[model samples]
Target: MAEESTKSWADTDSESSSSSSSSSDSEQEEVHYLIDDQTSDDEVFDFSNIEFTREDLVQALNDMVHEYKTLSHTFEEIKAENASLKNSSAKSSSDELEDTDSLKIELSKLRIENELLRSESSELKAEVEKLTK
Candidate 1:
């Protein structure tokens, strides 16, 4: 069974290589397939025959580096924005506290003024009674 499986794999590999060599990139793309995690072990194919030249590898590495740098820059920007938002939130909370303190001070002053007005009114009423008597 193992020998038969190996022979079948070899036969398929040879056919693929021959056809790929004769076809263009688009045609090769059509012939290739994607397998999922659920694929059986026997269904999985190795990419041993695929070869990358030095230029191809270098270009791929450079592209990956550029992508990494871009993502890192974006992450830093988001971190900075988050920090700025936190600072603004803290500042707003402080400002609200200051406003509440000021309002309390003003209310105390108004209460004192109200008491003084009441006392003056009482004094005026007593004088009016004396004058009437």
Candidate 2:
């Protein structure tokens, strides 16, 4: 049993070595083919329409930068608008609080007037009873 195991292990190692050698050869061939294909592809790129002026590229970049600045300014304006709206809301809330206080004062005054009217009606009832008697 021990001898059989040893033989099996040796056979497996030999098989692995042979497989690795074959894979290495295939990889080298693939690398050589890729190098040739790249050279061939470089010959096919169309260079006729390629612009050589640095000024054109610079102009395009400047335009993009200007647009970016405009967008940034718009964002700042929006932020300022939001802050102004928040301030307006705060002012309105204080105004509403003042209005609520005014309403409370008016309610107290009405209650006092109602008590006075009830007292006057009771006095008039007493005077009417005395005259009838």
Q: Which candidate is the best by lDDT?
A: 2
lDDT of 2 by residue, 15-80 (tens): 767777778788768866765666555643222335534344455556777999999999999999
Candidate 1's C-alpha runs over 4 A off are 1-58
Q: Please list the residue runs of candidate 2 whose C-alpha ends up more than 4 Å from where it truly belongs after superposition.
A: 1-49, 52-54
Model 1, position 133, has a per-residue lDDT of 100
lDDT (0 to 1) per candidate: 0.73, 0.75
Q: What tens digits encode model 1's per-residue C-alpha lDDT throughout 1-133?
A: 3455556667966787776554656655554543233356654234223663434445555677799999999999999999999999999999999999999999999999999999999999999999999
Residue 28 miss distance in model 1 (angstroms):
19
Clash list (residue pairs), candidate 1: none
